[model samples]
Target: MNDEDHYCENCDMDLYGISPIYVDYMDLPYCSIDCLAERNTYKKYKTIEEANREAEKNRYRKEEK
Candidate 1:
């Protein structure tokens, strides 16, 4: 997606200029780890590292399939 399309799913904030933009397991963008956690109530992630670990696991599983 282009810069115009990069926005946080939770707050709808522009993510184009933001460095280290957070993304969920589903590849949805967020302005911060807090916003990522807020949007994904089903998953409990205390930090970005936790979220990234889960995402990496899921990615491997998908690739294996």
Candidate 2:
């Protein structure tokens, strides 16, 4: 298997790969179904609806930070 095929050696997961591209917990990498599920909390939602909602929130939070 290739680097992409396996979990991110650095992160030890394989959730984000191929097609839409999986981005977990603030852009963390994953390797297997189990690994992906393990990061339910950190997983950055990939859906357009989710992104839009977070983007809107970020717009407001940016000023605070």
Candidate 3:
């Protein structure tokens, strides 16, 4: 496939538009930070669920104040 046709491995979304956040893992392209996190479980990187939970917590904290 051509460079323009590259898509994210996890979400299957077109990669060109969000290329800034693109990550390469084992020669595959991921389109977003979250997509990269979802695929890799290395140190200091949060999983999708952990990121979502943190976001939810921040949202609730905002609602309380």
Candidate 4:
């Protein structure tokens, strides 16, 4: 693997010897779901706080249903 492929694009976790690397829609790699979610949220909302707030609202709406 090249230098760029050796680490996750989101968390920079070493991908060497790690099986089943996670790839995003944009072809970005991640070590795990948490890292993927974090990067995706930030990419869409532009801030973690805003993404969290939206999640909370969605949770509340689900509870109400």
TM-scores for all candidates? 0.47, 0.28, 0.42, 0.67
Sorted by lDDT, highest first, which candidate order results?
4, 1, 3, 2
Per-residue alpha-carbon lDDT of candidate 1 for residues 1-65, written as tens digits (9 for 90 to 100): 55545888788888876753546455566788877667675357877677789899999999998
lDDT digits (tens) for residues 1-65 of candidate 4:
56677778787888888853556445566788888778778889978889889989999999999
Candidates' C-alpha lDDT: 0.72, 0.54, 0.67, 0.77
Candidate 2 versus truth, CA RMSD in Å, comes to: 9.4
Q: Given candidate 4, what's the lDDT at residue 14? A: 87
Q: Which of 3 and 4 is ahead in lDDT?
A: 4
- Could you tell which candidate, 3 or 4, scores higher by TM-score? 4
Candidate 3 backbone collisions, by pair: none
TM-score top scorer: 4
Please report how far candidate 3 places residue 43 from its true position, in Å. 14
State the lDDT of candidate 2 residue by residue for 1-65, as single tens digits. Answer: 34454555335545344422246555445554555554553456766577678778999999898
lDDT of model 1, residue 43: 57
Ranking by TM-score: 4, 1, 3, 2
| Per-model RMSD to reference | 8.7, 9.4, 6.8, 2.4
- Give lDDT for model 1: 0.72
